[model samples]
Target: MIGQGFRGPGADIGDRPETFAMAQALENCSKNPIDPEDGTAIMTTDHAQPPRAREQFRQHLATVLADLQETAAQDGEAVALIGSLATQLSDKFRQASWSRAKDAMSADNYDELLQSFEKQGNALHQAGRTKQAYAVQALATSLVAGTQRADTVIAQGEGLLDALIDRSVALYRQHLAKRH
Candidate 1:
């Protein structure tokens, strides 16, 4: 039987019975050919690390949200810009996640993923975060200027109203004196 096994032109039946036993075990355990459409093994292999990847994505999203929130609290214009950019960033991340879930991890596809991330970072930077920092620094100056202007207008209007009231009272007093 051993000679028959080794007689196959290039067969290497070594002197080790353990090796033969292992080969027999592997042959016995071999599964039937898989159908292309039934990709359970592939799905399990690819999705094995999905939870870790999801955690990483969530961390990145949190960072983006925090940065956008800080920028939005500065001024109306900045809030508008940052809020829009944040929305775009969120859409890009969702697209990236969908792409990954679909197993489109080719080099070109990865490059697109990287480009999306870069665009989000660039948008965040350009959304006036730095300018918002400056706006915060100048907030006290703006408040003082605004308060002074409003106070001046209010004081002038109040003074004019007081003068009008005084004149009306004087006129009424003169009318009463004449009636007496």
Candidate 2:
């Protein structure tokens, strides 16, 4: 929920500087947390992301696979489709991220740079350097937008895929009914 507790993404952030500042403060405060009872670590806001986010991503892929299996003519077809789609999407994601990173120092260092910026932004905020922190965070946002676009493309693809699934299911039911 890194972007949560902030103004809606659609809001005119430029029109409300105070809102932006407040959002930054709230974001920094919740970036990391500790379990109060057992004193265990709770959540982490590293570039690697929290476990819950990763789990949700896996579940999303599983759901898509399930839908594919429901519509595929055979189990092998479904497996092959998922494999192909996964490979294509991973390549696309890497390409997009690398395109963004190319002008910067080096493609391989892009991830490390993003993580460094994020950590530095948080550190600057803690040090009461809000303006500098905001600037650094904005830079990080720009770098990450490429991968975010890849995710959005996948989501858009899912929407179309879901429509196809619905149609396939309907046709399947009709065929079963006719057999009876």
Q: What is the lDDT of candidate 1?
A: 0.29
| Candidate 1 structure quality by residue, lDDT tens digits, 28-101 | 11112233785321211112223443333233223323433444444445443322332333344453222122
Clashing pairs in 2: none
Q: Give the TM-score (vs. native) of candidate 2.
A: 0.31
Top-scoring candidate (lDDT): 2
Off by over 4 Å in 1: 1-49, 75-77, 83-180
Q: How far is candidate 1 from the true structure (C-alpha RMSD, Å)?
A: 34.1
Best by TM-score: 2
TM-score of each: 0.23, 0.31
Candidate 2 positional error at 50, Å: 12
Per-residue lDDT tens digits of candidate 2, residues 1-180? 112222211223344333223223223322333457875443332324345553444343334334344535444333333333323322444532223222333333444555566666556555644434433433343333323223453344334443433333344444546889
